[model samples]
Target: MSSNVGTSDSASIYRRSRRQPLAITSAVIGTTLEWFDYSVYAAVAAWIATEFFPSENSHVSLLSALAVFGVGFFFRPLGALFFGHMGDRKGRKHALAATIILMGASSLLIAVAPNYTSVGLLAPVLLVVARCAQGFSAGGEFAGGAAFLIEGAPEKRRGTYGAIHYMAIIFGNLLGAAIVASLIAVLSGDQMKLWGWRIPFLIGACAALVGLFLRARSTDTPIMQQAIMAGEIPDSPISETFRDMWKLVLRGVGLVCGFTIVTYAYVNMQSYIPAVTGLSAGTAQWLYSLSLAVQIPLIGFFGFLSDKVGRKPLMLAGAVLLTVCPIPVFALVATGSTPLVLLALIIVSVSIAVYAGPFTAAITELMPRRTRYTALSVSYGLAAALFGGTAGYVVTWLRFYTASPNAPAIYAAIAAALTLITVISTPETVHRDISK
Candidate 1:
């Protein structure tokens, strides 16, 4: 009997080992779909306003569309609260699957949305509603997905696996960039602004369907299964998470502020720089995409290094560099030289990868198993809303307020300062077991 029991246990372990790669793949794919949907908004921001918010006053139309963009960021914290609780109480897989479904629906609606010419003010209103849905889904998706990846990975290999989470983001950006590049190549400038822009969002909606298919097969983590069997998981994980893991939540906010600034500088800033700094929009987009392509592999290298050294040293280095480099980086872009712009973007992109690489596992391991999702979701969601989501607006306002083109430097400096303060307070989670 003992021999038979040992054989069964061995088989089970072997089966689980085989599933790890698939789980990671699903996590990456799901995250890619979410970001593909989210990032497309920024990638096509200029064209999107022309389509949805067409009006006599170009500035009002653009601001309205961008405000809709910001609306998505604001609703994410609510999604985080709702789905984070569900992940802790129900299961991570279920929460992720549901969020992706909602994300797909929202993307589809944006794809088919009527223009302001056709529907009047209601057009922008509907756009906000769809974006909010996407935001809420996104709010919950990453924290749940990160928690799932951490729980699924082996303790010693957590950072490597966690790196795979950011790998998905790189893939998503690459795919979005590729789509934009392809569109730019084939379509006439007028065609692109009018209708070609809709193709990417349509593609995003379809990609979500593919992600859902992948996520359907993912198995629950052992930690979650054990909690279910023991009946130790809280019935109201949000309340319990708030009570027990608020410190981790604050740490998450600080760390995510760093990530958001990097994203804004590297990703969203490209869209606005053309109008504000007199750079060509196409030139700026090309630089942004090229920098991301270079940064993807660097993200993997930094993540791997974090596992060897620690998350704090790498993150702190990146934060300090961001503070120092923002002025030089933006000043170079303001020169309107393609080579200079590319150089500036690549410098900023590489620096951002340090935090992006290890943050998945680092954030997940901060809280106990029962409150992990809730704590992480609140921290990440709020930070993204306050810092990441508003980055474009803040920089634009700064420029408008000071009438100085180098306003992005001030934004980057603020983010770096916040991150520096938080780095001191956060615990090292690289060597810890998150699934427990």
Candidate 2:
């Protein structure tokens, strides 16, 4: 069976499709809700620990709660497998719609879940179940959302459309931060521990609700729709993707690692810099926000540039910049001045923006449409499970074990070098015929 049926009419029509805007909106909203869910949970993890993971040692309880959250990582690949198959066999719309509702319901479940004081071990058990469901939903979200958005885009405009995926995530996280901060400001410490934390979950559920409504009204991408109408949807996309596209998966994993490490490491500066350096938490946060402010506006420009100059040059440059960043990093930290740190943070943000701007569009274009959803999801889910969540972790450990703040810089460099190697070997896919 041929993987894709090339069709200019479908692509052209879909570019002009009335549903294109709606499709993009649905995917973006869904993606935002997914990340918002993550940010909210992390923000309230301590309360969750106290409420559901009571322990003799407070540290142990917190670790246990975090461990339960980490369990979501294990479920992500499974969700990818399940949704990938559904997407290829049924349709992207089906899988996305299902995931959105399930994700929302999962958040609601957590919001209303009983605490350890009320339910013994069942409280933690319920929390685990809800979090696992959330993980499963998120597993499919990135790939599904990207494919959905990019496939609807005009061939030349896909890069900018893809950048919106990353933008939505940033907004979700910022929204979470704002929401949590407001909750903290309005509530007393006791009230926060007792109930305020659940408010974010409720808000996340509401975001999911809006996304679901949008998705319910949306159509599958033009490429996927063309495949379905032509009887081209894969009957067994799971095994087929693994058998035929494993090399692509390997390359995708490398890209995921590099992208996640560089981008997340910078994003998490506020999380760890205070512990490692004399930077105050408030100062770190403002510096982080300033960086985000700088990067957010430029992502679209870099993505648009990718459309003009192709993805390879921009990505390769960004990768190389990250690889040799240790000297600059050391120089900036040596001064320990707030102004210098802010300047350094903005530079890091631009590097990440240059690299990530075209990343999703490039990766989405690489996969064959017959099993695009499955292949993309499996590769991404696997890489993210392994290394995507490790950026901050690796930094923390490297600093601890080596007792040098500069030690953590190698983690990002190694990941970037791996990505650079992969990018060097891959052909420029900016002009690749994704319809095939």
Q: Against the true structure, whose lDDT is highest?
A: 1
Overlapping backbone residue pairs in candidate 1 total: 0
Cα lDDT tens digits for candidate 2, 61-138? 655665676677668899999999998898889999999999999999999999999989999999999988998988
Whole-model lDDT values for every prediction: 0.80, 0.79
Off by over 4 Å in 2: 1-17, 49-65, 117-120, 266-270, 273-287, 325-344, 397-402
Q: Candidate 1's residue-wise lDDT over 22-87, tens digit each?
A: 788777776887777656777788777887877687655666667788889899999999999888
**Which ten-residue region of model 1 has the weakest summed lDDT?**
392-401
> What's the C-alpha lDDT at position 289 in model 1?
80
If scored against the real structure, what TM-score would every candidate get? 0.95, 0.87
The list of candidate 1 runs beyond 4 A from truth reads 1-10, 55-57, 277-279
Question: Would you list the clashing residue pairs of candidate 1?
Answer: none
